[model samples]
Target: MPSTPAIVVTDLVVDRGKKPVLRSVSTEISAGTVTGLLGPSGSGKTTFIRSIVGTQKVKSGTVQVLGHPAGTKPLRRRVAYVTQDASIYRDLSVKANVAYFAALYGRSRHEAMQAIEGVGMGDHADKLAGNLSGGQKTRTSLACALVIEPEVLVLDEPTVGLDPVIREELWDRFRALAAGGATLLVSSHVMDEADRCDRLLLLRDGVFIADDTPADLRAATGTANLEAAFLHLIRALEGVN
Candidate 1:
């Protein structure tokens, strides 16, 4: 039998001020796989992530995580979400912030320390989060999420302000997490980053225009890269009869 999906959304819809931000969006994210959500600005990528995180209410349809309905606090506990804003305590030291988050997730100090070290932030543990550079802050946020050891990891524009080197490093860590059996749902405007995912879910005007592996998407669109394929798919969808 095929493995059960870690996440399932059936005919999901979300509206924002009379405008439908998501229209009947449906997709499944499998265990131990990295699924990238790709779209342009205003395409509702963040909104979609918010819906999955249960921070945004939908108008219709169903969402399930680990077979439990969305918005269940217990179910959410097993899913970690890292927003693009890096919502860490700016005044707190890196270690303290991570420890606090871990505690919220029921982790002890020792476990939090291990998680921080795992993200290569051990040396800067004492530095204030606000004093760190953009990349360091992003890494710290990711460390906090990892401290929970969640079964599902969701990230929105995870490497937004990071330099190329740090972005590559973060991608390596993400791949490692997936390899270790964690399910990942990542949203990115960067086509290069999206290409690294096990599968891609392309959004256009709040709808899923294409869902396929990078290789398959490229093949289907006869394009050389994800960006080109994305454009092609959007054009095709727009021209649908």
Candidate 2:
């Protein structure tokens, strides 16, 4: 039998508050690759991420992760998710939070501290999560996710509002994780960040506009950059109609 994809979504349809958010979406994320989910606000990027993470109830379709259905008990420890909002404990120190979450994954304190240092948060490891800056808290949450050494890592807007240096650093870490045989699904609207991913899943209006490598997307759209490529594809589709 063929091995399963890292993540597979087949004919996924989701509705929130009785209003459809995703419409018949389907895709396969390859293992040990970085797939960037790109789109405008409210383009169903978050919904798609949630669907694969097993946090969103789908209207139809199936989402499978590592050969098992998404949100299954077996996946709880294998999949790591970092939302746009920092889910760190306000009262806990960064190290404390990372260590606590690590324990839940049956990881050691050394692994927790290594993750904290990976995110450049070691200097502030003892600071209260609430006291850290927004970007710092986000990094702390990222550290918590990394401590578990998950098979699949899902990150949403992980580089928002951070310095360019920090963004580069994080992207390096992501590449390293992918190199280590982890599947990474990262969502970011920032066009520049698209270049860092192995593949880009360009979503628009609850559908995939383009699903290809960043280079292929640029070449096919005849654009020099990802943002221009997005507009180019949309306009080409409009012209087709």
Query: What's the TM for model 1?
Result: 0.95
Q: Which pairs of residues collide in model 2?
A: none
Over 107-225, each residue of candidate 1 has an lDDT whose tens digit, in order, gives: 89999898888877899999999999888998999999999898999999998878898888888999999999999999999898877899999988999989899999999999999
How close is every model to the real structure, measured as TM-score? 0.95, 0.96
Stretches of model 1 off by over 4 angstroms after superposition: none
RMSD of 1: 1.8
Model 2 CA deviation exceeding 4 Å by range: 1-4
Candidate 2: C-alpha RMSD to true structure equals 2.1
